[model samples]
Target: MTRRPTQLLLATLVLTVTVGGCSNQNHTEAPPPSGSPPAPPTTQGQFTLPPVSPITPTSANAAPTGIPPAVAPPQVDAAPFNDPLRVTTAWMRQFCQTDFMEPINENLSRAATYATPAATAADITRGDTTQSYQQMQQQKLATRCDQVEASINPEAPATPSMVYVQVSAARTQLADGRPFQRLPLASTRRVVRGGDGRWLVDSAVDAG
Candidate 1:
């Protein structure tokens, strides 16, 4: 049966291979000394190579002379991915919950995590695709928020603060209608150190 491309991609991603010696036999017949005469030809003009010793027969139908072991080179220590200024998911959550924008914020700091500049630009350009439907949902959410906030006072330190944010897909929805159900969305984020010795978010991806 034919396998899926995604399965192949996943297998490639997970495999950790190392370069090592092969099992093929190679006769390292030393060449004639530099600038020396060429080797003499044998019968029928065929330059014959030295013979490899045949293995002795054993009682158990195995060779008495075992096959040469494949040698592995000395392993070296690998370097680490040691970047201190890395972004954390907590930072994205904090920013999302605290920041308030009615229409859409296209210039937010979350656009950098993409592997290419085009993808980063797309994340920004596509921000407003769901703005209309979100406006309608926002009103309902606002009412729910008011009721919830009134029932649970914010002044008390023990009270948990809950923020509501709706994330949608690629297609745009009307201000009073529902969004499409099956639009693909993905996000990746990374933090790198700033000049001031602090970790700052440097990259974000909305799609793979």
Candidate 2:
């Protein structure tokens, strides 16, 4: 009888040990397989960095990193222009200027801001057909300048609201990093004080 009771107790203890080992095995965590990529970080809010290379602005897209900021053009609407000649002269400087040797679409677009709405459309049309200021090769122009002398003509007196100015710009172009010369341009430009109380170039007939 004693042997029988001892055998029963030993069997019960072995069964309990086996069940406990299985329970522990089920609760333990397992690590991921080797060579697999780590899981992405989990965060409450999302964020991303700019894609490499594209955010860096090129010479053709942005102003030259070395040059100073350009001086603001004269205010065209600060009451009636006291000296129309002086005003138009300043306008020419801004209108005929380009920064970083940007091509016509990039550089001259600023001047178009001073153009009348109709004139702006006409300029785009002309640029597409008759004249092209874009360089054949992409390069920063050393400088582009126009020395303009303008005067309001008194001979054509048909329309009082309209004013005619004879503009002569003696230019030196360093186009596409090539040797260049002084090219003179003459134009009979029609300027009008638009309804916005600003002077705008309405029409221009170039005498090249």
Candidate 3:
């Protein structure tokens, strides 16, 4: 009977031990497989944590290694007209005088020749009168420049240098067979660098 009771107690203890071992086995879990990515740990009521990123540095502004800032050139003012080409208002004022008229008319003739054929023809037809266009030019100048006054525009642009001359004169007329007093005349002339780069009278016109 003592042997039987001791054997029973041993058997009971062994059964209990076996049951406890099985319970612990069911509760434990195996680690993820090698080469498999690991799952994130869970927080309260959540399955996984959000992803985290690695930090990178940034600069406000960056310039290239060898570049430099741009700078502008300085500007200078131009020189006086009379000082450049030795031209004065008096010189240009004589374009209409008889002795000076031919050279100026020659320039005009050249200008007209280069014009359209119709214009050149018209100039020829009108040039036939006794008061030839050249003579008329002289007469008109005598009448207008009888009382000549000149004003100098000191500053003008020229590559080899030039001068601008202006003349204000008067026009006279006869009314009722009596000569009338003079009326104000206005004209402008440009002295420019010609083909030779010498300052020469290039153009003249009635400013008004």
Best by TM-score: 2
TM-score quality measure for candidate 1 = 0.25
Q: What is the C-alpha lDDT of each candidate?
A: 0.30, 0.53, 0.40
lDDT of 2 by residue, 130-208 (tens): 1334332233343344456888877855254568777665444444333233444566667777555566666776632
RMSD of 2: 17.0
Candidate 3 lDDT for residue 71:
16
TM-score per model over all chains? 0.25, 0.50, 0.30
CA lDDT, candidate 2, residue 46 = 41
- The residue pairs found clashing in candidate 1 are 85-191, 85-192, 85-193, 86-191, 87-191, 112-203, 112-204, 113-203, 113-204, 132-175
| Best candidate according to lDDT | 2
Residue 108 lDDT, candidate 1, scale 0-100: 34
Global lDDT for candidate 1?
0.30
TM-score of 3: 0.30
The candidate with the higher lDDT, 1 or 3, is 3
> Lowest summed-lDDT stretch of 10 residues in model 1?
141-150
Off by over 4 Å in 2: 1-84, 98-103, 128-134, 139-143, 158-160, 176-179
- Candidate 2 least-lDDT 10 residues: 44-53
